[model samples]
Target: MRYLMFRLAHISDPHLGPLPEATAWQLANKRIFGYVNWRRNRKGVLTTDTLDNLITDMQEQHPDHLAVTGDLVNLALPAEIANAKRWLTTLGSPEDVSVIPGNHDAYVPNARMKAEEAWRPFMSGDIAHSGPLTFPYLRVREKVAIIGVNSARATLPLLATGYFRKSQAKKLAKLLDECKEKGLFRVVMIHHPPLKRSTHWHKRLIGGSRFRKTLAKHGAELVLHGHTHLLTKDSTEGPNGRIPVICVPSASQGFGNSHKPAARFNLFDIDGEAGNWSCRLIERGYSSEDKLISELGNQMLSIPNG
Candidate 1:
């Protein structure tokens, strides 16, 4: 029997707006200032045109599933979330896409406590909470399993910390075990990195070390995240094998700087019977008329790690 295969497009940290005035001011004073310096030195470019090009390219690729890791909004405002929902709708049906919340998504003081109430309309599966952690939820497909977790919550400005909560971690273990028994290719998604080194001190996932341990035990095939706004990759040795953790760059990085203008997204293809997988990075550029264009990069990875 020839098992089914699927193509998945992974993108993260779009940071849509309704950007708050305070945040906008910070970006202008700090990020924009740096951006101007870089541009003056002919180092980078910042523009929304990159995002437009990315969207157009993704539409053409037409992956079987789209996984948006997080930070769809800059300020966690209702208007911003609504705008993000509209963007997702334009991509495809809600069923074809899966999303999770980032720290910015939980703008209100108790946003984590009320995530389901605030963002349930955009999500497509059961999301009832079990204690403080509501996760290990499943998005089942004919060829793969998408497991999502909630790692975003309001934090003190000084701390800027994120947590998965103990209950959620334990639930994730059980979900992974079950999925493994069923022989499903599991793709775990979260806004925060499961490994500590993937983030810095102030912005780290508070329980990341423990989360990594859980994933190592359960054996996730691929782990996807955002939050750092830069392209990065790491791997962890797990009971089943080595699991690749891929971090995507910010889609809006071009907004403040023109020098570092390479904005990109990822495309993944998985074949079940052959146990083969391929991924490529697609970047956005512009034409002389200022129209957006996509430039495809070399294959990032081919699975079975030959």
Candidate 2:
């Protein structure tokens, strides 16, 4: 029997809102550098227009399954989570999509509960709660296995970090081992990159080294994440060689004056037999006359086995 190939659309860091006028003002007044960065890098501070454009572009791609890595809101406000839920509904049914919480989604003390309440409507199955296994759980398709993990949780005031508790790490190890034995094409998803070198102190995912060791042991075909809000790629060196880890920029971020193209999402096509995969970065923009533009293209890579 021939395994059916599945197409996955991966996007992250939309940072949706219940952004109050005051929040905008605070960003402008106190966080001047962050505000300037947002203006220069992201698309106009969370406008409905940005969401509309993203939804439109994603619809055009017609992904079989959608994976959102995290950071669905700027602040973990109940209302913001509600807004994110609505946006997710518009994208596709929750049954067709999988999402993990990001640092911003769990910013508040009751962040996880709030996210559960807001996001449960779109979640297809049970929320993984048994250690890191609560995430890193599997979504089995005809020929693909989508593994998701939760890396976002509330942290101290000074530290804006992501972490996977020890229990979760152990659970992830078991899950990977079991899935690999099944001969499935695995797509592992986390809000933070599995590699420590890809992150800095303030934004690092605590216990990242331990996590990487587990991932290296189990082996995954693809690893996707979105916490840094910048485009990056790293490889986890394994006994077999290297496994590709791909990070996408913020879906709602703008092109800015950096001359980079507007925000984009990735479409991945997996070959069942050859165990090969191809990806395209699809950019979303507006025409000079203010119409939406969809550009499908390839990104160059220099990795040895990527």
Highest lDDT, which number? 2
Alpha-carbon lDDT, every model: 0.66, 0.68
Model 1: ten consecutive residues of lowest lDDT? 29-38
Per-residue CA lDDT of model 2 for 141-195, tens digit only, reads 6667787788888776545688878887887778777766776667788897778
The C-alpha stretches of model 1 lying farther than 4 A from their native spots are: 18-47, 112-118, 126-133, 258-261, 274-296, 300-306
Please give the distance, in angstroms, between residue 156's alpha carbon in candidate 2 and its true position after superposition.
2.6
Scored against the true structure, residue 6 in model 2 reaches a CA lDDT of 71
Residue 259, model 1: Cα distance from true site in angstroms: 8.8
Estimate, for each residue in 52-107, the C-alpha lDDT of model 1 and write its tens digit.
Answer: 66777877877888888877765454556566767777767767888887886775
Model 2 / residue 95 / CA error / Å? 1.4
